[model samples]
Target: MIVITAPTGNIGRHLLPLLLESAPAHDEEVRVVVRDPARLPGAVRARVEVITGSHGDAGVVDRAFEGADAVFWLVPPDASLNPKDAYCGFTRPAAKALAAHGVGHVVGVSALGRGTPLADRAGLVTASLAMDDLIADTGVAYRALANPSFFENLLEDADSIREKGVFTDAADADRRAPLVAVADIAAVAAGLLLERSWTGRDSVPVLGPQDLSPNDLARIMTEQLGHPVRYERQAPDELYTTLVGYGLNEAFARGVVDMKRAKDEGLDTGVARTADTASRITFEQWCAQTLKPAVLS
Candidate 1:
């Protein structure tokens, strides 16, 4: 059996269909740990065994990982907690469960900048890397998909772009860095789970086809969406204050601010985009396919 966590989420929602489509041929049964079974489509729930609860819960992972060959792990963001508690604390229980269950191979969704100087200070990214360490310590054959900021993140700015022809971020206007589509991340995760041929622990960098800066993104959005788009660089302090004002934990707000600062300082530029590392989705393509619709709608 193969287990998947957060099956109704962005990455999991895409990963499930790919696994479900191929698992039958491989003689693999798919199981999912989810809080709300109803969030899964009727057809999806029928195809997999559902363990209902937060995967962060020891009891839920204990049940889900039992008799499972490989597992896809994803931690849903909880802004109520600090960075370490949000990522590492959430995975601690599951890490123990993996060892106890003796699951062979595991694929986890994680961030980039593991070996870079900025990694230790990148706040949330630092916490994510630490979580990867915790999982690897369990001695399961683990592959942490180290990914950069996703194109899907732009969806959060769609309304602002549509209304004012502008979007905001903490990065400098001309500082280029890799970005990826969540679909590509999901596809990579599915492939690893199905193959299960690799051993030991290592991170796979899912850098997209090319690097892009805020200005590049604005230019692409203008051409694809048929509107004049502009980039707005927000101060890190302002971003932090806004997040905290929205009732997020103070430490969590600082984590976001620190992450933004690191990315601006080239935290994500450590990885070179080669064929093996670069994923298929380009930002321009994603803008046309995903962003345009979201903005126009």
Candidate 2:
């Protein structure tokens, strides 16, 4: 049996079916841990057992892990003041549950630049690495899916583009950072679960396609939308205030600023080599396929 947490989330929606298809057909079962089964798309609900409960709920997590051979785990980012404590509190219980249940393998959705000086500037990626380490300590075989920034974040700037013809951030418009499609990340995660060969504690970094700066992104969007779009660097304090005004709490806002700082400092840089890792999707294709639709919508 395989258990999936956060099944209705961005990656999970794409990953669940792949997991089910990959499972051995005889008596294997695919289960999803969800807060409300109704929230799941009707198609997904039809295919898997929906165990309703919070990820942090001991009884709920334990129930989902029962007889499960492997699990896919991820935690949604929180902007609360006590963000770290909240993360540890939520993940620790689940780790304990996985330990108690003797689950064999784990595939975790984490972020890049963890376990380095860049970690502090990488926002929640740092906390996620810590969470992965905690889970690894439980003696379960683990794979941490360390994905770079998601191209989907561009969607948040749609309103800004429509009104201001551009979006503002804290990075130099010329600096480039690799961006990945959430679908590609899901594909990689699903592949790992199905293969289940690389065991023990390991981090799998998924670099989507290429490095792109905000200016490059704006240029791509302009060509796609048939309208002018541009990038501008906001003052750090102004960027902080804007994020807070956008309803992100202080801690998350700080984390966002720190991530921009990391990009500006070149902490997110890396060369793409397809040999040592999995194949990745490109930014231009992502723009044509995913970004264009979201912009038009």
Candidate 3:
């Protein structure tokens, strides 16, 4: 049995099929832990057992993990409090439950630069590292997919990009931060679940093809969209206030601002990656292939 949590999100939605296709011929099963079965996209809901409930719910998660050979787990941040506590608190019980259930392996989602002291003080990257440690102590074989920031985050600024021919952030103009597509992340994660070779590893950092600064993204966007898109450097306070007004909790908003500063300081860069180990997708490719269509529509 292979169980996937947050199965409706960016990674799981693309991963479930890959997992099913890779499984050995036997009494194999793929289960999806979702908040509402009815809300799942038609393709995904049709393929797996939809265990409906929050990933944070002990009973729900407990039921999802039963008799599982492997599980893919990740918790979305709560925009209502200090996100670190919420992340640790949510995963602590689930980790304990997985041990009790005797799960054989777990592939979890996390962020990059986890243990670096230079990581943003308010960033959830630190908290995710803490969760990775707790999960490992459960004695279950674990692989944390340490991913860089997503190229998909640009979608959040779609409206502004369309309206003002620009998107804004606090990142420095010259620093190129690694940005991976969710498709590649899901592909690698699904591959990890079925392979037996990488079981005991600490964490797998999925560094995408190349790093891009705000200016780089803007140029890619402008070229791909056939428009004069530009990058605007917003003040940290303005960024936080804007995010808060958009309903993000103040702490989460501030954390993001701090992270942008960290990115500017080059804290978001990771060690060099070999092409064979991870699939690499560039920012221009991501924009031309993914973002342009969404923006034009």
Say which candidate scores most in lDDT: 1
**Native-referenced Cα lDDT, model 2:** 0.79
Which 10 consecutive residues of model 3 have the lowest summed lDDT? 270-279
Show how many residue pairs clash in every candidate, following the order shown.
Answer: 0, 0, 0
- Give the Cα-based TM-score of candidate 1 against the true structure: 0.99
Stronger candidate by TM-score (1 vs 2): 1
lDDT of 3 by residue, 76-192 (tens): 888786767668888877887899899988898987776566654737776777788888889888888888788889998888888889887787776787778898889888877
**lDDT-better candidate, 1 vs 3:** 1
lDDT of 1 by residue, 143-222 (tens): 99999999988898989999999899999999999999999999999999999889999999999999999999999899
Question: What stretches of model 3 exceed 4 Å from their correct place?
Answer: 24-27, 120-122, 276-278
lDDT of 2 by residue, 190-269 (tens): 87777677777988877766677889988887887788989988988898898899888888787777767776776656
- Sort by TM-score, best first: what order? 1, 3, 2
RMSD of each: 0.8, 2.1, 1.9
Q: Rate the local accuracy (lDDT) of all candidates.
A: 0.94, 0.79, 0.80
TM-score of each: 0.99, 0.92, 0.93
Candidate 1 residue 204 C-alpha distance from true site, Å: 0.2
